[model samples]
Target: MAAGAPRIFVSHLSGVAVFDPAGDQVGRVRDLVVMLRMGQRPPRLLGLVVELATRRRIFLPMTRVTAIQSGQVITTGVLNVRRFEQRPTERLVFGELLDRRVTLTETGEEVTVLDLSVHQLPARREWEIDRVFVRKGRKGSAFRRAKGEALTVEWTAVTGFSLEEQGQGAESLLATFEQLRPADLANVLHHLSPKRRAEVAAALDDDRLADVLEELPEDDQIEILGKLKQERAADVLEAMDPDDAADLLGELPTDEQERLLSLMQPGDAADMRRLMSYEDRTAGGLMTTEPIVLRPDATVADALARVRNPDLSPALAAQVYVCRPPDETPTGKYLGTVHFQRLLREPPPTLVSSIVDSDLQPLDPDADLPAIAGFFATYDMVAAPVVDEAGSLLGAVTVDDVLDHMLPEDWRETEFHLDEEEVATDGS
Candidate 1:
């Protein structure tokens, strides 16, 4: 569903039927899984607990739900199919929240939660419980068939529901800073106590933790990874960019590295191994194994679609590489680069090979950092392909990765400021 979707009351969603893409019935929504935040912030709606025909319940993440309209839920048809097990950080709307009694912050009067209204945040995929439908009456059954004066109020208007205690762990802190960008969040983590830092790290989801870990200093990355369960640590590593993952893995003991590698997917582990084989300051080590690679016959439309993926960094999306065959990395003979600007200037049906720029030379895998930096500067390129001696395209290195390595080790810690007189002179 798009952002700004209409508010959906939990009571109205009771036993709502859920269907797959082709109109096949999958299950019915039994409960909504949410994680409560500190004090006044609304709780984040995680997903739905759906009950299958076979009496099995599975958790369907909100990301998978394509739409919730006309009293039915539509899914993208992809599911884990595993049984639903609520984590310590999760709460069920139907099972736990419906019948709860809370106090109205405005009047110190008791209220019973009748239902909750969830709405999607504008421009974001997140859904949150923004309003509480409560009744000002003595606590009775979860749904008391409309007893006293009922009204909808902001989520913050109620006080008994949020985390009553804040100092015990990072739950409150995490909730407070949930909306921060990765770089800002990294700064926050850097200033936290070691124990609290680990707590926050452990609380974050795998994907989020991966992004934040990439921004943190090497020492913090090592410390956080060291404290996690080995299996979880492996999963986090797999979620990280291949180049960054390899860099972090290179800092561990040989035995430790081998152990984690064994737990990762064979394909992912192989990529990490290949990257680690190169010198830390070489093109091969600095390049990410994942890139937009297509055969010569692929159309501009296909390349555009690949570049539109939200997960790709801007530098990686700035260009596409056309190869002979075997589209994945270690792709067939490297062909030519197609800038996104060129794609926009051509028709959608035009073949990428016809417009490819073969005049630009690719970087050798063994190119040193200084050589690679000079290549980018000389060409005014944001990204460049790394080809092996055999003419196979291994990966592409982005400008961001080059800057990360080129900057001084202590640059992240250094603070820069100017006096008022200097600022006035330079005009900021």
Candidate 2:
């Protein structure tokens, strides 16, 4: 289980407290971050910590690991301690580690840690320090010198890890589903065949797939939906907002659309059909089924109570629409929307009408999306209510929901600037 010269292998040393050649306490073992696509190369060393008092952590390259001891980890040089706070881009690691429990290097053995109850570790996954260290100023380079200490032992050498051994909060990638960045997930999904795409989607839990689907483009969405089984596709579409669901379905051919609709739950199928009835570019098509509706006579207390409903979207909605009595127009006649934040800042039992924005900017059912998007910009509104000629409230559309169409899928990947230059460079 050892590699050749220029690399030293040690035993039973995962999460071992790493020290410099001078034996200065540096940090603890984070994880073995390896490029699996790179084959059987020695994995890189990633040390974990946030700050000195905050429990600072740093990454040491595979080259920096000098030797692994029976119970101690030794490195070739001191690590440059960087506070996690100073690295926004690095926040991704912390969020990944949040709620993830790791086995501590204790007495040359590993044990399940119920909780990471440590103060320095943030409660989100982005806080986890799963990093790969390259020689300073040589990011993405295949070969680089190790930091201070050149060798360290594998934690598995000293003691065996139990399948029952749980990480405090982090779920194993294999046991659950792969937790990939949105862009990375999109890349994989884009390249997968129809059968494999459905397999991948089915394997993942609904929550994870919902998030990944939200980040994909309309074309990709159509491809993925086509691959998915009717039942599974219906489930995924049901989880999406009506506007998103409508847009995605509109991309499909007539036969495929009817088939997919046939597979959906009765209520969801009805909702989608209703949304699809309108012109593709209209406000009706863009309106999301997600809206905050309240009866006009309901007190501020009642409105706040409705807001507390777990099912409410936008945990913080700018306005709550006042509806007519359930018997008259259950969909509710468009009265006005009250700003929830205003009520919270100034508690009041006053009638909703007293605080409601009666002069609300509204969208006609047939208004084009670009026109609707413009309404968002002009009014600086997070969402605008859509109505028919009779002023009957249909649904509301939020800025984030509409902007999903405007933003480009590849916008994020451009930051790495990985093109013919880097790929060619790395391939060599």
The best candidate by lDDT is 1
lDDT score, candidate 1, position 66: 80
Off by over 4 Å in 1: 4-33, 47-89, 103-111, 114-119, 131-139, 142-159, 163-168, 295-302, 347-351, 415-428
Residue-level lDDT tens digits of model 1 in 1-428: 66766788989888999999999999999999998887688888989999999989988888778899999999988765557777666789989998689999989999989899999887556789999999887876546564789999999898987885536556767776777888777777776777778878888866778999998899999999999988778878987999999999999999999999998878899999999999999999999999899899999999998887666899999999999989889999999999999999999999999999999999999999999999999999999999998899999999999999999886666742223332111111
Give TM per candidate: 0.78, 0.53
| Model 1 per-residue lDDT at 307 | 89
List the global CA lDDT of all models: 0.87, 0.54
Model 2: worst 10 consecutive residues (lDDT sum): 112-121
Error of 2 at 323 (Å): 1.0
- For candidate 1, the lDDT comes to 0.87
